[model samples]
Target: KLKLSLQEKKCSIEQKDRAISDLSMEIQLKLNEMIHIKTSLSGMSSAKTIIEAQLSAALSQITGKDQHITDINKELTDALTSIVDLKAKITTGEDLRKKLHNKVLELKGNIRVFCRVRPLLADEIVKNGDSDSILHLNILSENSIELLKGTANCDTSSMSGLKSRGNGAVEFTYDRVFGPKHTQADVFEEVSQLVQSALDGYNVCVFAYGQTGSGKTYTMEGVPDSLQDAGIIPRTVTHIFTEIERLKEHGWEYQIETSFLEIYNET
Candidate 1:
């Protein structure tokens, strides 16, 4: 009976040992599984951190690019403004220069005299029929005329002796001179500036003086109704009205008065 009890105790001891070993293995397996889970979680956290850092860097770059674009836009706007200001200044400078030029012309005795030579009429050409007669008159420059006294009766007492000594040509100088070939339009071009002076607050008068058929009437009043054949008077009227319209932008208002007077024989 003692042997049997000892055997039973040993058996019990072995069974308890087997149970403890099994429980320890199960605990080790659970610990390994927990370790694996922890390692996986740490890796996932590191990946998340890297992704967040990349996202932050990308946002910063976008903000910086946006700011740079804004600065470029501002610079372009400023440049355009400067260009507009420069253009305004240039316009003002041009206007000032024109005003000063007109003032200088006014100070230099704007009452300038221009001489025009009348073309020979068909009747006169038939009467003279001499080509050399045309050569007697010489156009020296745009402002000078020379009348050659070639064995012809010429009134030279009033001349200033500016001619060549042997040629006996009386040289006459005026502010401007027009040749016989000059058209009505050509003459009005020079007279237009003088007409503008009247609009600029100046008393202006243009007169014609010569022999009966010396183109005085033609210069003052061309083919009456024709626009292309209009004279200085009509052209001056047109220009004055046009300038009045143009100067409205500069705050200029004008009143024009008309006067007609005939002073034949200095009456």
Candidate 2:
């Protein structure tokens, strides 16, 4: 019986030792799971912080871009306004120039005189063997003429009756003088202002007075189809029509009348 009791005590001691070892293993496993959960939570927190920083930087950049766009819009508006004001000022300046030009014409007699020398014709050149004979007519200035000796068919007595110097050279003054080299375009420029005056409700008359074959017809009437060589009448008509079109923008309408009458030999 003593031996049997001793064996039973040993058996109980061994069972208790096995239970303690199993409990220790279970506790170690629970500790390892808790450590893994903590590491995961730490990584999540770091990611959240980085995301917040990026969001704030993005917002700041958006605000800066919006402000730059607003500034550009304001600058564009100002530029457009300045352009409008400059255009208005330019229009005023043009009107003032026209007024001043008209005033000058009124002061200097509405009927302006301009002299033009005709080029020597082919027949005249053949008749006068000396080409230098045509050079006897000297253009002293834009408003003066000097006819040297032997150029005009005037005697000394006849020249004295007129304004002639002792050298038998005659000098005449006029409002404007054009030499033989002046083109049809050049002559029309001087007459254009007068045509403009007529368009502005003023009566204007342009006449040609010279000997026969002195380029009067050529100056008054050039080739009808040629634009560069167009005379004063055609150029004036073209200018009037163009001005009418331009003035249409300013609420202007016009009705033009046409009339042509020629008197030959005063008949």
Candidate 3:
């Protein structure tokens, strides 16, 4: 009976030891699983930190690019404004050039003419009383003359080339035209530009040629006593000397030659 009891006690002790070993193995498995889970969580945290850093770097680069774009836009706007101003200035210059070219073209000619209509003679006023004057001649513009054709107004019959047209009025254009109202000074203003051409080394001639009693002498060799009626010849001589004096300050010198001639009956 004592031996059986001792054997039972020994069996019970072995079973309990085996059970404790099994429990220890299960605990070891659970611990390995926990370690694997912890390793995975650590890797995920490292990846999150790398992703956040990459996103931050990308945002910084975008900000710099946006600032650069803004600067370029401002520069482009300024360039456009400058281009507009340049175009406006160029247009103005071109217009001025065109006007100058047209003026030059108008002044170009070998035989330009200036027609000066003298005041009506005292005898003509007595004979016709201002009737023939208005009927015969009309100053159309500063540079145009209109001569009416044949009427019974025979007072202006001697002024040839004025009565050639047989019917309606004939309009004539000239480089310039002066009415009876214009003063000698007024005539000299336009003629002065021509005198300037001569100063620039150009050959120039100013003369008057017309029928008898047509005021040719009056226009060329005006009343010497009247300063206001002084003719082109005297004004030109004085202007030439005056200009010579003015130009002396610029180291210029001049010589002048003068000639006067009269031809009668095509001689």
List of clashing residue pairs for candidate 3? none
Candidate achieving the largest TM-score: 2
lDDT, candidate 3, 1-267, per-residue tens: 999999999999999999989989988998998999999999999999999999999999999999999999999999999988887776677556546644673566656888988877887766665543655778989889987656455554545555456565678899889998888899888777677667656566777877789888778778988788898878887888897897675456898887778877896
Clashes of each: 0, 0, 0
Better of 1 and 3 by lDDT: 1
- Which candidate should be chosen as best, given lDDT against the real structure? 1
Would you list the C-alpha lDDT of every candidate in the order shown? 0.81, 0.79, 0.78
Candidate 1 worst ten-residue window by lDDT:
151-160
Runs in model 1 with CA error above 4 Å?
1-98, 130-133, 151-164
If candidate 1 were superposed on the true structure by all CA atoms, what would the RMSD be?
Answer: 11.0
lDDT of 2 by residue, 38-103 (tens): 898899899889989998998998899899899999999999999888777767875776688789
The window of 10 residues in a row where model 2 has the poorest summed lDDT is 151-160
Question: Against the true structure, candidate 2 has what lDDT?
Answer: 0.79
**203 Cα displacement, candidate 3 (Å):** 0.4
lDDT for 100 in candidate 3 is 65
Worst 10 contiguous positions by lDDT, candidate 3: 154-163
What is the TM-score of each predicted model, taking all chains together? Answer: 0.58, 0.60, 0.54
